[model samples]
Target: MADLLVRGGTVVDGTGAPPTPADVRIRGGVIVEVGPGLAPAGGAERVVEAGGAYVAPGFIEAHTHVDGAMWWNPDLDPLPAYGTTTVVFGNCGMSVAPLRESARGPVLDLFCFLEDLPLSAFQDKVPWTWERWPEYRRAVEGQAVSVNVAGFVGHLTLRTTVMGAEASWGRAATGEEIAEMAALLDESLTHGAIGLSTNVFDKDRYLKPVPTRLAEDAEFEALADVLARHPGATLQLITRFNEPDNIDADVERFARICKPRGIRAQWTAIPSTVREDYLREQTIALHRRLRADGVDFWPNVPHKPLEPFFNFERALTFQRVAAWNHWINGPAETKLATLADPQWRARAREDWDNRVSSSTSRLDRPESLILAISETGHGPLGISLKEYADREGLHISDALATWIGHNGILSCLRGIPDAFDEPVVAGLFAEPHTLTNINDSGAHLQLFCGSGENVYLLTRYVRDTGLLSVEQAVHNLTGKLAGFFGLGDRGVIAPGLAGDLVVFALDEIEVRPEEKRYDNPDGSWRFTRGPAGVRATIVRGVPTVLDAEPTGERPGTMVGLVSPPN
Candidate 1:
């Protein structure tokens, strides 16, 4: 007898297949069968009223920061609302595993640099039980999350274990240390870590020439060998270049590192930025080279709109803050004092007006500057430094300075000079070989307009801009992501997938920009958003979010590297 049944769902199987009207049956967490309709089999007791929902496979967020969120909040919101049943945590070479009481690792600093959330508030809420990867996995086993999650053994985490935080930055691991690291990685993989992750960028710090930078070509190759040991495993990396020729070399090196080990290595993003022509040609070349080397290498192109939010805690966007740390990462009074100091203010004005402008030519080009989330929610987002200054009736230069002083840490992304070609970015996501996912959901809690990535993505690109087909957009978010990570069973809706899904009212999904809310840490403002059209969301046959708020039914799992029984 089935444990539960869902009747009258429009199933858009994540296989890029068209929707089909059917009733899905579930038993013991797995979809037992699906067809037009059927009478109760024996004693199927419960039934879900899926009158108008489109039941597809739960979303697979390949890149996420829920490793910390889960430790802090069990019923993670926003994530479940996207129908994300399984999220791939420990992305970007950072992990909460292999942590030891004595292991002071550079990744720890990296993690601190990443999130400024006051998760310590929940210290009395959850027990800090596990010290290893497997134990942590077990600890989360029965927790009721709106979705399932898979853990990965991060590369920086590997380094952190072998060499404590201080040593990891400058010194390369000795041969014995490397072997020890390898053993630890193998153990983690066996314990259910899905794959490996490493990043080339540290949104905050300027990485110097260090061991992570100078890892012997052989070290990464060895890591790839470890990945090869798991045939279905995947790799997520953020490289330095997407230029055609340079990207080719990068892909070549990565593929060569993975081919012998039979691992698939994918880059974090191939966004439509200033380097579009180079990125497209280079991407095509990368696929070609991977084919030749028999290496599974593909870049996960983000078709989503992006806006990284922040306040002074995570990434303090004001330049020269490094030279003035006490003014930023320090006490509030000190920060306010620094802002009020005439000497520093005069110096900053001097630096921006004279030195900063020297780099920009007189030519009228699309100026690059980080946009601020002034209006509070996602609606008044992307308001540029230029716009903000104009709105306040001041010169752009004066406004920029005052903005930095007044806003402190609550600014979004700083614009780096790059050419823009929206069409190229659209084409990239539109390609079948390329997929889109903005893996920033759990990370930028306060700084940017990044939390509601899916909202901006669906509304902006697909609906407003007409960049992609709704089917293609949904496919990228659902099927493409699952396949990349080797979670075959839950990617598509069929007779045997989990009944994880979402149903939005389409036109109602717009999000209005609002200021930081219920500031977690003494009102430490980062960024907050609310979407318009999300009607209902479900996870593993449970309604985790109804009308866009968390329902506290955590039906998630600590997913393993290998696929589960069909």
Candidate 2:
């Protein structure tokens, strides 16, 4: 007998096929039938009337930093609400396993620095009861997660575990250390890790390079050999792609690792900007050439502009610049003192001027920074910094600094840029090798909220601009990602597949405005946004989200690269 039946809906099937009226029946968490006019064999236990809605396979988040959030937010709110039934965590070289007792502080420090997680959250919330990857897997598997989680063993954690604090400072590992790291990775893969993730494009909060940036070629080749031994394992990387030759070199290294073993490699943050048209063309062409040579290389492209709401209190964007690094990374008292120092302010002005003249910095245009929320009388609400600075006859940096000094920690500067070139984005989506979702959902929580990108795509692209058909959009979010990540039985709605699905009305879909929520483990505030028009989201035949609300159900399970369903 069927456990649940979704009746009278237009099934899109996540295959880029046209939608058709069909009834889907689920028995014991697997779809038993997907056909028209099929009656429930035993008058099924529960029935969802998906009439006037599109019933499609649940969306898969291709990249995320939910490694810490999973511990505190087992329900994983705002994610399942956005119709993401599965998430790929441990992205960008950060994970929470393979830690020795001595390496715990440095690993957590690295995570807190790179991912912007609060130190108290890890110290207070995470149990810290496990050391090995398998033990960590068991601990996570024992939890009640709301969405399917497929995690990767982070390269930083493995290196730190093998080499101690030296790894944090980017020291080169010896051959013996490399061998130990490979063995640890193998153990992690043996016990349900999906693959390995590393980063070359990130820096710590102190403006130092991450450990993976200093890794030698021999280290990565050894790790790749371990991945090669395990046939379905993948390599997730954050490569240096600002320069064309840098991109080519990174791809060449990845191709050398993946091509011979038929291993798949995925990279992130392929921006949708008109400014880098020539670079985009060269990168896409390189991707094609690599694929033609039989390397399963894929670049994850973002569907939205990389804009975020930031404030001087905990700004992640400005920290990249050398001048602002001291003020941004210092303690509150130190920042306060520096903000008042005339000499320091003068140097900061010079730094801002230099950055403005450079073509590389996104913080160049003062007009792009608008006041979102504030608690001071320095300027009226909704005024751009450039306008305010011009009216007051002050440099933009000085004006911003004065406002922060007066407002303290209560000023929010938001960058709400115009949308990207729609036709170009549509073309990228239509490309065969480009994976379109890299939301970075659970990271940078305080600075921005990108978890809503899935719903944003559905509302803006499919419903509004008509850049993507509903079927194509659904395929990009679901089937293509699942197939790429080897979750073969879950991305499509077919007989014998997992009954993970989303039901939503096309016209009613909308992404809500961002708001602050103090929901993290230590009561630190982070921006959050919700979704509208999603009727229900089911994971493995259970409704994790129903009627636009979480049902408090956690039927989600851990998925591995080559392992069977958990």
| lDDT, residue 377, candidate 2 | 62
TM-scores for all predictions = 0.82, 0.94
Per-residue CA lDDT of model 1 for 400-511, tens digit only, reads 5466565554544344335446566666666556656655666656644444555555676677878765555667778877777877667766666666666654466665
Top candidate when judged by TM-score against the true structure: 2
RMSD of each predicted structure: 5.0, 2.4
Residues forming the 10-long window of minimal summed lDDT in candidate 1:
357-366
TM-score attained by model 2: 0.94
Candidate 2 regions off by >4 Å? 41-44, 243-245, 353-361, 562-566
lDDT of 2: 0.80
